[model samples]
Target: MLSGIENAINSVFKPISDAVSGFVFAEVTVFGVTFPWIVAWLVVAAAAFTVYFGFVQFRAFRLATQIARGQFTRPDEPGEISHFQALSSALSGTVGLGNIAGVGVAVTIGGAGATFWMIICGLLGMCTKFVECTLGVKYREVHADGTVSGGPMHYLRRGIAERFPTAGGRTLGKVLAAGAAVMILFFGIAGGNMFQANQSFAQLRNVTGGDDGFLGGDGAALIFGIVLAVFVGLVIVGGIKSIGAVTSKLVPTMGIVYVVACLIVIGTNITSVPAAFGEILSGAFAPEGVAGGAIGALIVGFQRAAFSNEAGLGSAPIAHSAVRTKHPITEGYVALLEPFVDTVIVCTMTALTVIIAKTQFWTDAKATVAAGGPTPDGVTVTSESFASALPWFPYVLTVAVVLFAVSTIITWGYYGQKAWTYLFGKSMLSERLYHVVFCLFVVVGSVLTLGSVLDFADAVLFLLALFNIIGLYLLAPVVKREMTNYRRRRREGEVVRVK
Candidate 1:
């Protein structure tokens, strides 16, 4: 009865969600597309942090590798999971549909140039990841019951309590924390779960053609819901350990498979590699390649890149916060690796596959589609490019996409569960119920027309970034202070011990 009611309520909100999305797009369009500006500002912020952090992401890269490799898996750390598990969990959240379909969208819309910008964003974003995640660990709180609950909220509240004794500071911290919690919840359901499931279904439907025929759309969603609900139940019930075990194995395997496939496609057309890059760099500035097409290439580029790495959107720290570490900056250093893996490496491979395939065989008619009409190929644009280079690629990509989508769903289930526990109390009942609900949505996400839902969810995610970045700025001094303390301990031959 409770689950039914929740589903009804979610259904009821559909119209409101559509209206909000319509309004948001309309408003965004009026300001001459603020997305470009949003992207630019985030790029600048990330860049500035990189400079200020003394290139810590670079300097600490080797140490991070060692940590991830289990060199520091001491049994006495004040956290729940290992460094590898934390990285896997975070990577699962990111290495999803965004890398697959998002890259295709970036290339189609932004021409080649968006790939260049995506790379830039990934490189600089490492610094932003380092700073924010360090704060997450530094200010994380241990509960009376010995459980850990942390993220921007704990840090925001504690940091404000200490640094700004004024009531205004307290109020602002509360407001930001509240806002971030809501955003995280919304993002968890919409982008993390629904968007992924929806795109997976869309791709499947396309691959199967209409022969597989969806149950009436609602019915189709219901079927998806039932299957995912069961699977999510099986994993999440075991909590972080189960989630970690699955993702640790899944993320790296799927990532390598996808990369290898892309390399195969790119190698087939190795001659076009230079031209593909040249086009990307040039197209980014002028967007000439997508100018005559229906959709603006520039819009495609930035949106895809933004969606892929989630740099400014600030959803990653929540996952990173779970790492078992005494030095907050250690997790931060690991966090920096996400965008590099997601955008610069994986996304770049997908983009290259598309461009190289396009250059070799696709016709002009296959290239152009006016703005209102569908793009010449749509999501399979990248796959088509691959198929052009390697005949068996479509099947290989199908497996890769399935792995990406499933791993993403499992990881995001934990994110939503955490947010649910935050909003409601951390009752066992609440945790179980949240998992059930989240899994059901996965099916709904798979079968539904979730394009608008994804957009709305993404918007909420940005709201999170807004709150987090503000808190990050406010607490910047604390982060620096901790770093100095860490460095001092190390330099003094104090042993700087951590379990």
Candidate 2:
């Protein structure tokens, strides 16, 4: 019966998913390698935003850190969470599985050179996050109950309408906003919720023997999912405040633990570090004769970096929108740090660790994979890299993976909730029902394949960029105007330094 339901779900969605996937993942050959044009679209937007803002990512980074520390924020600000909490919650979403498995894949397939392009993408993505998040806070809605809601859905509608009042105005904005909401709503459930549950359980099962551990028997995944769901349900019931409080601590703890463990592995083989950097730089621009070649490396690096940080995916804005601040740009300033921390720092660590690991472990694994042998997945490669040096680090990795997955799940729950409210009315009953369904997906995600769901989830998220980028383009002038006024006020001593 369960298998039937899973198949049925796939059957219904597969056709639509296939069509969407084709368009979304359409390849354009560059540097003698084919990559999804969507990657190019996102990178172009990041570059454009960075140049338009006069490299605000570099100049405003210090101010961003200050805002995150509450230095420039008034105590009596009118929003749901603090700037720091908002950053934490948003980071929890981006700094999860992508930082681990995704980085490993990029290095393993794209080769060492991919790391160079990855850093470049990370730097540019910071500007993209700044633009969307600033608008997220600027156009948010505060309900009568003191709860605030925002994101691409709000800004695309409110911001776009303000810009094009004489040219179909709100009607056009509503169309784009509605489209983005529906896509993000689905993305939240599949990519955000189910995907997290799936990976977290997979990692747990890896540590504990399959069908041998306490909860590893038949229906183990389902049972584990139920318990996990209950835990997540408990935290999410209180809304953003609840999620924020948990993620604020959880993100920092998980990050420190992972980074420290990575350092231990890297530090053990400290002498190889310089050589690894050399390989990365040379690999990035290798001649066509090289494996994956220059283009392949660049494509791999940019795509992985984009996926890891999710700078312009428009999801972070939802979390940043809830920050307590009189100045929306303050949150924007703080948000620019997300890509740097996620990709530039965390991802770089993962890539270096993988690149520097002894090839002794991959001799047989790569052989098996070369000749119609069983596929050795990237996650396995990552595990082998850690085990090569520390020998006992897999246990530590299991804990980090679970924590990263959990943190992302909870943050995404908030994102999905807001998107849900955008489509369905924001009623108490409506919210409770959404929560119940979300928890149920936690269970479903653990037990099912649902490949179509993954495809659809990925496709729909790019649609977020479609609507979001359009809205950002329309509102760019408004943001520029406000920025000018803010600068003038600061120069005139009208803006106080709360710190």
Best by TM-score: 2
Q: What residue runs in model 1 are displaced by over 4 Å at the alpha carbon? A: 1-37, 144-146, 212-224, 284-289, 292-302, 359-378, 450-454, 495-499
lDDT tens string, model 1, 149-188? 6777767777777799899988988888778788888888
Q: Estimate the TM-score of every prediction.
A: 0.87, 0.95
- Global CA lDDT of candidate 1, please? 0.71
Q: What lDDT score belongs to each candidate, Candidate 1 first?
A: 0.71, 0.86
Specify the highest-lDDT model's number.
2
Report the alpha-carbon TM-score of model 1 versus the true structure. Answer: 0.87
The residue pairs that clash in candidate 2, if any, are: 113-284
lDDT of 2 by residue, 1-499 (tens): 8799989999999999999988888898865667888888899999998999899999988878988999878878889999999999999999988888888777766677888889999999999999999999999998998789999889988898888886698898998889888888898889888988888887788788766886577888989799989999999898889989999999999899888877887898899999999988988999741235677788889999988898777899999999998778888889999999999999998888888885555445544533446645667777788888778888888888889888888888888899899999899999999999999999999998789988989898886777778777778777777667777877898777877
- What is the lDDT for 109 in model 1? 54
